[model samples]
Target: MEQQKFEKMYLMQTVQKTIVILRAFTKEQPKLSLTELNKKTGIGLSSLQRFVATLVYEGFLIRDDRTKQYQLGLSLIHLGKLVEEESSIITIAQPILQQLNKATKESISMSIIDGNERRCIMNIESSYALSARNHVGDTSPLYAGASAKSLLAFLPQEEIDQYLDEVAMEHVTENTVVDREQLLEQLQEIRKQQYVFTRAERIIGACSFSTAIISNGRPVASIAIIIPEARFDEEQFDELRELILHAKFDIEKQLNK
Candidate 1:
């Protein structure tokens, strides 16, 4: 009886109970009625009503008045985008980026596909005097460079098709793939190899090696090393690929955690 009281008291934490209610919905079972939610969450009917009302009011949930079922709301997607933009990948990749800088002695960056473009959210420079010219906020077309290909390779099939159908490829350099058929083939190759190497594609005199960091079955960001064409060594290509892959794995692991 004493243990039962303690258990009941523990469940009284509003935040914990709210999270439990939210977690009751899954990918397999995205919508649930009030009775279903109560059964799954082990929340009593009265308390569940209060929590559901509050969550719905706050835009965390949407209720179907006709069916009396509830589903996740647009607010969660908005919150997820904010987290993607501000925290998870960037915060998790910082240490990995530092380590890559030390290992490669080349400029390293993390790029995310933002709409039809990719944004360089983080760039760590090598200790060496000369390196690639990339800043934290640099944005480039998703159809152009090694970093862009690494991201484009793992996007969903519909999104990829939409991209190919809509966007016009600009000829940034002679190496840039402005042809749709050729670029689609290249994207497939990148998906298979899990990396991309580009020579003066986006910028003249800059070569890049990149691989995507996939989380939850899709590419969230890409890890890349940029070097001047004069300094980029074919002999070091395999070594650099391995280094970027390791960093990608590290970031993905953190994201999963």
Candidate 2:
């Protein structure tokens, strides 16, 4: 019985160390030599080699002979896509997006912050002949659009300040908030209101209203309705905002469940 417990503990330690080694690679450093991986992961060369060999055999990592470095293997891509397809938020939002699009006849988009950028992970295009369009993989500055603002507004003050300080505010359109102080104030207001409405902030002639979906006490994703500015109506805006907010709330409940 004592021997069995010791072996189980050793196996758990090995699993934890393997996870540390795997996490050492990132987008900025996709490939790493054994020496670098050792330094980054704090794992000794001999043990690292054994783990790396097993990982490569299992198709979780690949080695580049010329560079004598390892990179994430292709198998991860398939696993990542599977995770996205089955993600609770995506699964819940899929049917909701279709329903929202049918009711509003407007483009619906869902985005999450990817580093300093907002990545549109899902988009349901409007049925109207002339409508605003954002593709699933489209990326935009986090400071420039309603979809991003909803998420950004809820971040910690220090993070917001750091982001604003680090990111150069580009004038994507005439209506975009180019002044730092004004943008800061707007972010505060957005946090207070729990929503954001932007007109041509990122794309000319396009307007959007967005709200964040909170889960695990943080903004996990955002949903937005984008339409041509010419067709935007002040009276309809309130109604649409409520609908979007309701959808966000429902999705949040499912995510929390």
Candidate 3:
């Protein structure tokens, strides 16, 4: 236990040092040499060298060979743009998602693709005492769940193929589809119908209806309504489907603008 604690503390200190080095560059000093960075961060030259080299290798910093000065890199700009887009998406979708939650009294969510997983970026919980609860930042494999499959289904064919080729599908629940061929067929149907319905795939006793939010003829995210299986009504399915589809349409219209 003592050794583990010491190792963890050491790792954290190393991380703090890295942050300090990155923070040393600012608007007033957008680029810095190794000596300047050491002075600004109070880290020794040898340690600073290792940290800066790692940052440059990871594309978080770039060094000009001629000037021997380092500046923040393009990767930081890409990450900043991603954060901006996610913030914009949540801002644009929240009101519509609230309306959908009010109309159906069910959990409503917006999800986006994050590498090999689907991550919920926005969620409004159901109003009922017994509800299907999924919070923001919840993640599941791309091959499972209505929300996840809907996002996967809308990706370009090449991406879909690459994902299937690389990821090993494992069943999350008894109802989860782990067979690639069956999953492909389901994706085909989802594309043709423009919506996905699933039951107990990720969480037992939960059913979800999902559709993609598209911009510029490509899917940027997905919207889902989750409800308890006990309360699922076939008679009300059409109404619920229409509500989610309308939400998708409204969000997409605003996003495209």
All-Cα superposition RMSD per candidate: 11.8, 13.8, 1.7
Stretches off by above 4 angstroms in model 1 are: 1-76, 81-86
Q: Each prediction's Cα lDDT score? A: 0.89, 0.89, 0.93
**For residues 87-199, what per-residue lDDT tens digits would candidate 1 score against the true structure?**
88888899998999999889999888888999998899877787785788899989889988899989998999898888878899998999888988999999999899999
What would the per-residue lDDT of candidate 2 be over residues 17-54, giving only the tens digit for each residue?
98898899999999999999999999999999999999
Best prediction by TM-score: 3
Q: Cα deviation of 110 in candidate 2 (Å)? A: 0.2
Worst 10 residues of 2 by lDDT: 77-86
Candidate 2, residue 87: Cα displacement in angstroms equals 1.3
Candidate 2's displacement at residue 55, Å, is 12
Tell me the tens digit of each residue's lDDT in model 3 across 1-257. 99999999999999999889888989999999999998999999988899999999999999999999999999899899778877878899999999999999999998999989999988898999999967888899999999999999989989999999999999899999999999999999999998999999999999999999887677779999999999999998899999999999898888878
Candidate that beats the other on lDDT, 2 or 3, i.e. the better one: 3
Regions of candidate 3 where Cα sits further than 4 Å from its true position: 216-218
